[model samples]
Target: MLRFEGKVALVTAGAQGIGEAVARRIAAEGGSVVVTDLQEDRIKALAAELGDALAVRLDVTVRDEVDAAVAAAVERFGRLDVLVNNAGGCIVSTVPEDTSDSEWHRQLDLTLVGAARCIQASLPHLVQTRGNVVTISSVNGLAAFGNLEYAAAKAGQIAMTQNFAARYGGMGVRFNVVAPGTINTPNWDNQPDTLEKFKALYPLGRVGRPEDIAAAVAFLASDDASWITGHTLPVEGGVLTGPGLLDLTPTGPFRKDY
Candidate 1:
């Protein structure tokens, strides 16, 4: 389905992993994509590979860069129909109490404030086109996922999206979030065994894939979700349903084969 035909989308952190997956999905669905990231080489290669895509070296943490990226999108595509805020990540590694103010500032600046910057820069064009914004949040934002700073920043994204949705609903510009669980992204490359261990913790018996998130973001960004605004769609693998005990496993009590 070409849900994004004749439309344009700007995705932050579109170098690889979830961001790259989202960009590919949008392009596959017939949208012109603006792929922005600090990885100049990767983004450039990806944009070239995608044909109708633009590569913008955007550091979402910087306001000037964010504004410039948005402007570039409009200039290149003639309009911006969607803004995918995919730049944020878990940066603070310190424990909650041990986390320094500087660390907290950096975390929030990158995740929370960064998304706001993109939205602020894209708002005018979105308003003109009656467009939408899809933010990639995390399940950590909804529950106690251990990383305090990261969780807080993710939660802030949810709150910010809700407010934006409410404020801009009348203008026909929607705002929503895709809160995903442990996706097998490059972030887990260092800990090869970690994703394996994480699978047992999920009720679905497997960890998430970047394509899983791309699908959710696509749904929320498309006109298919026209009435969906200010909502956080948890695309987790049913991990949020309850404690994912071993009972759900094939050999466990909850399993049955026909």
Candidate 2:
């Protein structure tokens, strides 16, 4: 459980949702965490709650801020053992036809390029510690789901992971990704019924939680997954395997209590 007892991790957008979950999980496992987000108050509050955590204001889209945040993490922790690129989301445009050029660029810059910047900034320390990177991508990147621009950016993260793994694996740094499906986060506050709608799609009979993704991320970042790199772990409750066909059957496949 204390896989990161002596490690230090830097997480982006760690104020809420999956990012916060990841920071909490890492810290729970004894890692010193640097939590960063645009919301300074929330991140500072989270840092206070996390005891050994440090809060840094970061806007991933800004190169200067990204560099400064990385420097601050090293200055505070001496070394960065993990970098969780969790600061990303889709814009209002859900479909390719409706997505404007600016929207496309913005999505790619924030979700894809922002991650690249952090990786670049943290690689030196990761290489020094022989650490790893766990990027939070989405299932939309692997399948033809909605949110075209966001999906494209997420897919880019996967490609970057593979390339970085190949390029840096020999140097002791690893790169991997976790693709989550229909997570029930604050983003769905406007659609209270969304969880019910997504439940029928997953074989597990429910959508995902932030903790679900956090668990996978912790595993990938831990030494337990030291040999695993350039891989995409789909912590999607079997939604990517296929639809919940058995749920539609009259007897529920085995007819057990159906």
* Full-model lDDT for every candidate: 0.90, 0.89
Model 1 agreement with the true structure over 40-114: per-residue lDDT tens digits? 999999999999999999999989999999999989889999999999987877657799999999999999999
Candidate 2, 9-115: lDDT as tens digits: 99999989999999999999999999999999999999999999999999999999999999999998899999999989986444456677888888899999999
> RMSD in angstroms, all models?
5.5, 5.6
Off by over 4 Å in 2: 244-258
Evaluated against the true structure, the overall lDDT of model 1 is 0.90
Off by over 4 Å in 1: 245-258
What residue pairs clash in candidate 2, if any at all? none
lDDT of 2 at 43: 97
Candidate 2 minimal-lDDT segment of 10 residues: 249-258
Please give the clash total of every predicted structure, in order: 0, 0
How close to the true structure is residue 19 of candidate 1, measured as C-alpha lDDT?
A: 98
